[model samples]
Target: MQESHLSAAPQRTGNVIVAVALLVLMAVGGYFRFVGQNWDDFTSLHPDERFLMQVASGIGGPTTLSYTDPAGLTQEQADQRALCYERYPATSGIGGYFDAACSPWNPQNVGFGTFVYGTLPTFSTRAVAEVIAGLSSDQSWLTFYPIHLAARLVSGISELLIILVVFSIGLRLHGKWVGLLAAALYTLTVFSIQQAHFGTSDPMANLFAALSILFAVCVQRDGKLRDYFFFGLAFGCALASRINLLPLVGLIFVASAVRLLPVFARGVAGYEREAHWTQSAVGIILAGVATLVAFRLLNPYAFNGPGIFGLTPNSAWLDEVGKARYFISGEWDAPPNWQWIARPRYLFPLWNMVAYGMGVALGITAVLSTIVALWRLVRGKPGALVNAVPLAWIVAYFGYMGLQWVMTMRYYLPLYPALVVMAAWGLA
Candidate 1:
């Protein structure tokens, strides 16, 4: 088996070639698939993609966190508006109404201010690609393909990195075969791959999300500050990419506790590594500082003269976040027999949306695997410790989503890699 062979020895040369080929194929294919839609025209793009592309093209900017409807708005227009939280009530994270200084362009304290100007990383890539293509940066002089190509390149890279991270984690937890299978499943997902093809922050955010969890897994085994540093860097940047990922910060810690508690209680030399308060404290501080610095680098406008904890109401993102939360009322006023995964037929779209894309077979496999894994966990299976991170993260994210009424297929992406692993392993 590949697992035994890979465990017995590292075939560095073959592995690199195969991995590079796969990445190139995925990126190029994803780029072609999107551009094949006549991407040269702005109308063909997704609203968010159009926003980011226009920003990359010239002087257009992203919508503000406080965006309200303009007159004669279509559903598309309203949907395009940013999900600014109600400033009147103030979200749990902040006080008072929205700040005028941060209204249109710099609206987010928790995330980078760039939310107003689209994803800075995508913009930065467009700028660099223009230089490489020898095109003038002047809006009037530049051609569109380079910028469009750059967006695809950046997103595709992000998706590729996500697969690599998933592969690594799967390899670590269950050896080569399961890792490869999980990576393949993650890469094959239409939503995740589609995220890569688009010009949004999601791909980059997914990269960081997968990395944070992968590093969190590493921290479980070793409890190293360096691991925490990496985790912090990724976690901070992931939040910077999208504030919606805030739940993951807590989920990772929960996984750590579930993973480490047994060792501490039993004093098992082989299974346990002591988690020191000093180490954890310093690591957390380092993570926080790193997060601040990273968010600043990604979106510097968030940093006003004296922001609190690197966040000011002017640029903090909590308001928009709160608005997003409140927007979805979870209005499941349907018959009791209604399912949650069947579009209008389902009260909630969470499971329905997932099933629509994950395929019936794979989805069924995931459910069964989750059941077996949980059953084992209930029975105190020793080896189940490593599997706990994915399980806990899926549960945490799902539980959070269960409260949300706005159902997006992409929203479930961060949970994809972990679920894939459990499914594949459980089947075997």
Candidate 2:
């Protein structure tokens, strides 16, 4: 017994060693991308920094600044403000591009972060920032870099974990080599690497989504109660990260139900001697409850207090929402719209079709995989849901982006791992 236990220790340690090495390699590759490609984004001071300073000024701070805006202000007032030096019309030289230059110190305008402030509560960054400030009594946003790194690192780690879980699922369903290929393909996929390098919420949310599915798989495999708890935690984390995570969440419950249905019927038919239905039921309930609570906690309104939930006043939200809707629906045109989907927009008659082409390619393959996986499940293949998780992930993600007025491969970075996995599985 002692010798057997000791032998097992080495295998466990080997697994840990391999996982760590893979992560170190991934980190090195991510660092290279960060320095080589995203160096501009990191080195260039955020244009919004000036805007933030202006916001800081109004709360009795010393950084008072002014900007001119012809649309919303009088000619005399617009001329006097330094930030508003160029009127909106003047900047429209290249399809109205040159007309909207604002004064560097103007604080009245809000961009992505501020515009989506109401959605902040459901994000982890604010909570992480609050924790740091409260603990250190430091108010500087620059000091928040550590917090940001921590959050990003968690996202990176989560990607690695997803690889491991996906590999295990593949190994259980197919074989060890298939598992390795799936994990390798996922790790090397272009989209996954890009998302892993960028410090964004999407990668972290994707990690959680992957884990939630993994846990659900375990439950379907008649895994322990602890697996359910973990599924709940991961589900909650995903919800907290992005509202787009809803479809993935819904899929988890549905997948669990679908898998469990046969199991329940089997138990009732005496096909199996005993079935732990109560434990499984409790796990599912726990996952749902945890996800709801996490969604509430991550909401900025919940963190900051009520009334602030909307971030902007009702009027502002309405205006922004209208713009956001238009921008998403393509009713409002953008100068560089649909460029990310395909290079050389001139090659395509309409830029919209370029994105559609990319979407169709990804969507068709995913749909086929889904149909195949479902068929396999009906044929009594174990771990069908587990193997299908990555395909499901990609399909759900593409569906979400399809609703947006604009889509970019970069934005779909989080779903890259799933894509790679699906491709690998299909090829293998």
Candidate 3:
């Protein structure tokens, strides 16, 4: 008993140290994210953020019993009315949310015929802005400056959450020290800090992506039904924040497969330890159902909506998506396309990521860590396979995005959590 107590004393002390370290890291990271949130000075310098703010400001409940004809209104008046959040009331009820024609909630109804970005971040920001507007009796909260600032706050919070989730991933897979190291590294990442300062959806997308990876680690560790469900939920949220994170779905299959491998190895004997195939199958199905339900709920505008489950495809949204894809593919002749025209596929992105985004030392460490993780997996080292789950996502996502014509640094934000985790593990 004395030996046990003594051993536990050090464990408790270690846990306390870790907790304090994490708090300090979070505070520093929050400062980095929140400090320059007003850097644009109401100028709407970031075009993407400006567009998001416009959509957010425009979304609200129905203003009338029926669609207001825009024909009579001048174009400027129509745009102003579309952007007015105060025009809708709570008394308008849930039905207004699904009304695509004049429901202020719909981006398409906002006179912006094309909204290619994900809806979740915009909706979330608008909801928060409305609450502030109501509480302060300040309608200015619905306008561009205050509202975009609110969005930046949301982004900052999301980045902080990403740090927490990355820490959890490392702790679960490796240890407390690895988790702290990973969180510290991610907190210091320039790309993450920059994204967090913007009002765009990238930080939220990165948050959800990190959350999905954390839950994937949970699934790999325990294969619990809740783990699978939450993994799927996080994945759906990630996708709803940014369609670029669609590749994260592959992590689900990787995690599920890792969970089921032991069952295959032991055959009938594996069933003895609660590693039943039926439970895993059910978990996978539940994951899929949860993902679909979450995606639908968060991105209702993507469907023909009169309610949450409106499953019929929204043709306009689909068309916009296709058009955006075509433009981004560089097949269309556009000003932005010119920069990427002669740029080499993988090298350009790699150079930017190493040189400016992650900094040189950290980037090299991440690469070496990934290679070491792969080698350990090949050698069948203990814990190597679970580590491979994140590596699989890193490789697959990077491969797909690296090949794309759009090689923007923010596009690679989703990979940072896994890379930091791998780097931490390698260092430890």
Candidate with best TM-score: 3
Q: Against the hidden reference, what TM-scores do the models get? A: 0.71, 0.59, 0.91
lDDT tens digits by residue: candidate 2, 80-152: 3443333333532111111122322112222222333223221344345456667878755324234344334
In the range 122-198, model 3's lDDT, one tens digit per residue, is 98898889899899999999886689998998999999888899899999898889999999999999888988888
Candidate 1 residues 132-196, lDDT tens each?
56654354323455466667677777776776788788877787667767766666666665666
Native-to-model Cα distance after best TM-score fit, residue 93 in candidate 1, in Å:
31
Which of the two candidates, 1 or 3, achieves a greater lDDT against the reference? 3
Cα lDDT for residue 424, candidate 3:
87
**Relative to the unseen true structure, what is the C-alpha lDDT of residue 129 in candidate 3, on a scale of 0 to 100?**
90
Give candidate 3 regions above 4 Å deviation: 61-95, 266-275
Clashes of each: 10, 13, 2
lDDT of candidate 3 at residue 333, scale 0 to 100: 86
Ranking by lDDT: 3, 1, 2
Best-fitting candidate, scored by lDDT = 3
Q: Rate the local accuracy (lDDT) of all candidates.
A: 0.61, 0.50, 0.82
